[model samples]
Every structure is written in C-alpha cells, then in structure tokens.
Target: MWATGLGSGVRALTTTRFGGHSRPPFDSLNLGIHVGDDPAAVQSNRLSLAGVLPANPVWLNQVHGVDVLQADRVQSDQEPVTADAAVTTRTRQVLAILTADCMPVVLADTRNRILGVAHAGWRGLARGVLAHTVQEMAMRTDGQSRIHAWIGPGIGPDAFQIGPEVRETFLEIDGRLEKFFRRDSSQQGKWLADLPGIARWQLLQLGACDVQWCGLCTMGDPDNRFFSYRRDGQTGRIATLAWIET
Candidate 1:
C-alpha cells in the first residue's frame, strides 16, 4: 500500500500500469513474466523497477498457496521459486509478489529490520497465506516487538463476488469469518467477500496492530490506472514489494 508509517529503513511500494514499454493487455509496466507478455518487454519493465530498488526484486511464481520462503534462500532470478510469500531479515533483499486482482500483503517489524510480502487471493487466504507469513516473520523477532502490516490494492470487497463454496472454504476455518462476507443480491448464490478484511483479521490474530490498506479496487477503477485480470481476462500484473534498506 506504499505506507511510510512503518518507520525508517523500510521501503515498500505497489506499481500500477502508468509507465514502461509493454503493449496493450500488458500495456506499459507489466512486470510479470508468466502472463504471456513479451519476455523482453517484461525484462525492460523489471529493469525500470530495479532502478528504484536497493537490489533486484526476488519475484515469486505465486501459486495461490501458503508456501513462504526466505528471500535469500531463493537461488535464481531467472527461475522464481514457487511460493505465495517471502520474508527476509537481510538488507537489500527485496521481496516481491505480483498480482492484478489478488491482494498483496506487506509486513514490517517494529525495528524495521524484517520484511515480508505475500500474495493472497481467495484460495491463498482460505489456505492461510497471511497467517503463514506473519508466523514466519514474527519467529525472527523477539516477543516484545510488534508487527505492522499493510494490505495493497486488489479487487476490493465490492468487486470480489464469489460462490458459496468459496465462502464455505473460509467459514470452515472459523465461523467468525462470516462477518467478512455479504450476500450478493446481484448474483444468486454468491457473496462479495472482503479480501482485505480476511487478511486484517489474520494479521490481528497474529498480534499485528498497525494494519493499513490502500482501499484501491483494480476492477472498480474505470480509467484502468491499475491492471485488473478479472476486469480484463488477459492482463498484466502490478507488483507490490517490500525490503529493508541498507
């Protein structure tokens, strides 16, 4: 969500489709290589992002699962590890997760020495990606330090209508999760689930208090300021990244 309140030595940002060289569908700043976009154009866009980062981003081949990894353990940039989230205590090790309609959640410890970024869609949320990430990051710090998390833009609750099974997936975890969903009158047997709300609950349960969200809905913006894979079937992905500055 590009929050600065996490304090010094912490750097975080989420990209939109405003600048770069890819053509329509992936138009201009498409940083994801798995989206069928031209490889060179994606590389060019990655370079553009690199200019602002302390080091090259350790991008993930996000699979809507709960797998979380240490950023330094990732062996290659050419072959991104298949994980939905990444965490690191090392400086300049930028942790990145790409998304269009899925939520990107970033976390910072009180000291700003540890950072984590996660990709959470309905599947990942139901599978506990947010919980897994917080557990990984919190384990690195002592009991007294608080964890802060920010929810980056994705398809907001107003636009994220889902089927009954999707709702069931979460309710199965905790009946209290029912508060994050509402019946979708527009679509029979469907509900608009709050992706950010689910993540917020997960974060708070893990003792993260300073949780903030950008409140931007990729599908709701008519101007196409951000990419929306749900609004446009074939589309580029925007990136949300986090890191500790040297």
Candidate 2:
C-alpha cells in the first residue's frame, strides 16, 4: 500500500493485515494492547510493522477523549498516551492511532512541517477530539497554520445508530453538526450518525483548509482488510501512522 499525502511532504499510511505476525481474531497485524490479543503476538505484530513506519509509533492509550500529546515524549510500554490526539514536528518521530470502528483522522500542514493524528469515536468526536487536534497542531507552529486532514476508514452511518444524549453532545458543540444525523424513526430518541462528515466539519471550523476522507466502512467491509469492533467485539485494531522522513 502506498502512503497518500495531501500533496505535502509528510509520509503517511494506514496499515493492512497483509503485514505483521498476528493470528486469527487479530489475524495478522493487530496493533492494540488493551484488546486482549496475546501481548507477545501484539508485540511481534508491532515489530513486523516497524520496518515500514518512519520510526517507532507513539501509541495512545485512547480513552476516547480530547487530550492531545506530543509524540516524541511518549514512552514505550507505558500507559498509552491516554489522549485521543497526538502531534509531531521533529523528523522520524512517528504519530499513530489504533482503531477498529472509530475514525482515525490523520492530518498534515500545507508545508508538511507538522502532523497530527486523532481517534474520533462517537463519544470522542462529540467530545471535540478533532478540533482539539487542530488546536494542538496550531500551538506547535506559528499558531496560524492552515492544516489539511484525511479521515481514515471506520464504521459507517447506517451501522452507527446512537441515542439522543450522543446527539446532544455534538449539538452542543456546534448545532450545525445536527445535520450529520438522521432521526431513526423506529428507535425513539435515536439517530443514525455520520461520523466522517462530522469529523471533516470539526476540522474545517478549527482552521483546516482542505479535508478528505477514505469513505470505507470497517463494519461493512470484511475482506480481511479491516477489523471492526462493532461487528466483532473481540477483533483486532489497525494503525494509521505518519512521520516526517529525514
């Protein structure tokens, strides 16, 4: 798989199971630690993916919140970043996020001088992870850089139905976001969520000039290319990583 940059200098990619040493359930390239996949297998899977990554990836603990961390300071085997987002400026310092059903929103600036990655689940997205990531990236640069974002694969709309409380969260953040949800006629106080579009809008409002999406649904496509938590609760996770090549 080739890494697609937004015509920027950043080297970025989303991994497929074709690589790594993980086995069934995780199958071959699972990169998550808290998912109950064998630790040794997860380690081997990570090592197998390392050669392709620009540097060791900064893996996050991912509690589905809006916290953003700097990748270089992240220690290995420690409590994962806990933050849903991470930003990096130095070359060879990789930024990554693991997800099975949530959108992994990867970003790079126009000049490719900095990169940021965020995990946006329904809760995290509503909690402002995408906007927080853009804010963090701005803090690292001139505080006025125009960024670009590419939202990676995740569970899609028809598959992600949520209750009114979830809708209220985004509505509170930006009432315009309500346009992303369609009321579920059968389920009282429930709506079908448009996760990718919500993420794109969040970034745009934060300062990004361009936003693109892969538009693939992890739950809908099970061709061994993706792992889906919504479809398989015990399944593995995929990594979306980026770094500046020195």
lDDT of 2 by residue, 143-184 (tens): 568677888888888778888788888888788887899998
Per-residue lDDT for 1-246 in model 1, tens only? 365666577889999898889998789899989999999999999899767787788878888999998876764365788899999988878888899999988888866478888999989988889889888887787656567888888899999989999899889999999999999999889899999998888888888868988888999977778899888899999998788885
TM-score of 2: 0.91
TM agreement with the true structure for every prediction? 0.95, 0.91
lDDT, model 2, position 130: 81
Q: What is the C-alpha lDDT of each candidate?
A: 0.86, 0.81
List clash counts for every candidate, in order: 0, 3
Q: Compare the candidates by lDDT and give the number of the best one.
A: 1
CA deviation > 4 Å runs, candidate 2: 1-5, 75-79, 185-189, 222-224
